[model samples]
Target chain A: MLPFARVTVIGLGLIGSSILRATRSAMPTVRLTGYDVDPEVRGIADRIGLADDIADSAGAAVIDADLVILCVPVGAMGAVAAALADDLPADAIVSDVGGSKESVIAALRSALPEATIVPGHPVAGTEFSGPEAGFATLFRGRWCILTPDDATPEAATVRVRDFWEKLGANVETMTARHHDLVLAVTSHVPHLIAYSIVGTASDLEDVTQSEVIKYSAGGFRDFTRIAASDPTMWRDVFLNNREAVLEILQRLTEDVTMLQRAIRWGDGDALLDLFTRTRAIRRSIVEQGQDDAAPDFGRAHE
Target chain B: MLPFARVTVIGLGLIGSSILRATRSAMPTVRLTGYDVDPEVRGIADRIGLADDIADSAGAAVIDADLVILCVPVGAMGAVAAALADDLPADAIVSDVGGSKESVIAALRSALPEATIVPGHPVAGTEFSGPEAGFATLFRGRWCILTPDDATPEAATVRVRDFWEKLGANVETMTARHHDLVLAVTSHVPHLIAYSIVGTASDLEDVTQSEVIKYSAGGFRDFTRIAASDPTMWRDVFLNNREAVLEILQRLTEDVTMLQRAIRWGDGDALLDLFTRTRAIRRSIVEQGQDDAAPDFGRAHE
Candidate 1:
């Protein structure tokens, strides 16, 4: 009853390796193959036996794959698709775990004309990257957004959805443009802001970097965990999802400016009102099982 | 030898109740008392036996205590001290757990001119507020900073330091001004930005609030934990530490603007450089034991 009896994962990074592990754990009878652009990564995958086969090249990896998931950076999706185009099976259902979908979908369509494409983005990750940092449980209980265009066949989308559901993800479908905007607010810009603030904290002349690290438990440490996200993946995300990310970042800047004014003018009520309102969102996020209800994200105090 | 034989914590909120619980756990024989202006909080504390006594008034809370720690909002520290001034035992040392030290020191000095004072800030907390949310291990492995001015007796500072150490905190001494500046980057402004961004995300017209909550796991949830901090406490912090918070905020805004420009102009290299550099800070935080080394803050996936 496997949706993908023979699966191939390209760009064997965190998400790719994770899909391999999850498939191995969930549908062991199904064949799993993985490939990375870096030979070192492929060697590591081989050493770990991450899949039934760690293919030497993209073309060989997808030649027999019923389902092919491109797990490289969004900016590299087209190139990866192009690399495997001639060898890919005509009947193969192609999907991806890219953050930004509009650009990725366009790139993929250009490289794989007439291919069944259903791009997806799983809303879960640790800051760590590379093959070793992934886990079988990463996609469990998390949302995996699938962006399937008009040209994509319903059967292909359903197979991709089933593939994710079998791996333990809740699937939702949306247009690539809407997906980009929603993710811009929730994921892409949040990472960008986290990165920007950490950079700002480190560059401060008055507050030594040591002090920032020591006292980070107050709030900055929460950001450091996020600011530590993979650089190449995130850089490509910003570049690919430019319009939506810029739009959300502009709104955030405006809101922050309003807060700055409130702080400068000693408007405690304005500050308190906004702070109080935001708490309810956190409550809803927890109540909806999107985040841990445990205090401090369940951080151990002792 | 115990540094404090009798401790009174006025303001039965998260930090205040936590101090009482930590004291009971670490120094069982010490006399403890607590008070809050909110009758409901005081009743909850009394019902739970949070301390040896739940005083009805701030004045009655510290009448015979050898140490009094005001754990209310920074803006209320002066009022709490003035309320307890007439009944405060002459030999008692007063301290506070305020985010901004310089203003609190001024307020306490003005309210209790003849009293020995040591101002402290515990760089630790959960997003939850009020008595029932506190626990004995709240301060374990966190930093407690004491800012005692030249006019304050050294013995008073030492006694406060010893008290925090007994509660399993590492104590450090610094000037109140320096403490404010340090926390501005590490804590205050970080909290402000978190609160601001959460507000921004919730107000997005294109994206439904429900969508934001469901996809929050990506990175926004990391911010919600911080944004969920007590409004009254954070409001007072920003107002009291305006100068330092504003200075740090300006730097963060400028850095974010640079990032926006980079993203808009497709400067992936610039974004990658900053994102890569920020990862080192996250590593140092883990190495220093300032934050959990667990990936995704050790959030459970299944």
Candidate 2:
């Protein structure tokens, strides 16, 4: 049986639009509705027939949805949830696709206290945003983390889990607090470092911007891809997951300082030791099927 | 006419084997020879027929070559060059594929004063190393920067440039000092940061290594791909390009500090501005053909 007969997705950006497409492809009989804060996105969704119905307003979209997912940024989850609170079906299960779980769970629960809230984060995305950048296969073989507290109903969590599994995600259950910390190290801090390094490269007086762009294949190109992620979404992630991100950043900075001192003192062994250890982690990641085993992350060469 | 009819590669690693393969494909009639200090690598290269002849020693490899490209780590370039100095052909042009040019040029010139020295760095590589991991297309459409000082012969410089072009690389000339500085920003520091972050992630007491590997798709996988690079090569790069790399690291640290404060104070505006600016740089890199326009760097998903 399908997890939800009527599903509504708010915020028709990459993740939300991808959900619509994936749901349609996987369970065609299920009804779908979509809405976006941006009118232009809504118009595009309508033109492309992204859903069974393109709701003009948030309230209209979730009026009858058995499952209403807040696909908006973490900071905007409260406002988006509150907008549809009165219109949402009495038996609906509310979920979200936020990078950080604690803040989202808090915001979502506060907005809809009577709702069955089961927050999730699908650990998948590209460097692109907007409705047109998503595809049905985006979630295939990726992890979808469900951060449901003890108070959450078992049936509600199971339905949410099944829905993500139908969309080709490997679902795992965890606490909201742990999810935030794990994601902080794995996603948020990595992105912050990428953005900081890219900015550092661009601001250099010694190196021309053209030179940086031309020679990016050396390694800088990888940072640019992550840094190119949606600004508003990432800003919300940092703001909401502040403590965890700051703690991870502090750890990263200490490591960087140690390496910096090693470089200054010409300590080749210390550098090599760390470099060697990191290589093993890459192997573990590839072996776990989290990434491809192809060289250079399987970057296409033309 | 080919740039060099008889070319010897003195290091049967990724870059050397790739040069041999690309040379065989592009100029089938040219004679190629290869050598490595490790007998096991030599045995593998011989078993795979990586070159027409796998010399037993570095001195034997360059005996009759018109051009010899040293593909050893920067730290070993001096020793490799010294080993071949007496056996090198009187008119042979010596070159290298080192990440940093200045130290390599100095080492080669000091070791073989009378030899025609032209150092080049192909701004291309995958995390995989060794002869068997290489492919002929690694250098296709990639930039090869040649560092030939004023004292180097014009004929020698042109011949080296033409050789790289025949191997499907776009060649450019620059001073060795400037090349070191630019690469310090683009390649060296990026690698250092990647290594540092990966090290930090692995060392976290609260997060298990398995957790880091499983959730790597969140963004940590990108850094791992770079941190998995050859330790010896990267060690040599950091040690030899000390000044420039340290300078860039200092700049990157300052930028990270600024962003840290922004996140701590909940300054979303500052964070958004930097994230937005970085996206433009990614677009520029893609437009300039330095990286593919495909989302997520066109990483193979399966």
Q: Name the top DockQ candidate.
A: 1
Give the per-residue Cα lDDT of candidate 2 at A236. 100
> Worst 10-residue stretch by lDDT in candidate 2 chain A?
A293-302
Q: DockQ score of candidate 1?
A: 0.90
**lDDT (0-100) at residue B149 of candidate 2?**
90
Fraction of native Cα contacts reproduced by each candidate? 0.92, 0.79
What is the i-RMS of every prediction?
Answer: 0.7, 1.0
- Distance from true position, residue B151, model 1, in Å? 0.6
* Quality class of the docking in candidate 2, CAPRI style: high
For all candidates, state DockQ relative to the true structure.
0.90, 0.81
Candidate 1 lDDT tens digits, B136-215: 99999899999888898888888899999999999999999999999999999889989988999999899999999999
Worst 10 residues of 2 chain B by lDDT: B293-302
Candidate 1 C-alpha RMSD relative to the actual structure: 0.9
Worst 10 residues of 1 chain B by lDDT: B149-158
Clashing pairs in 2: none
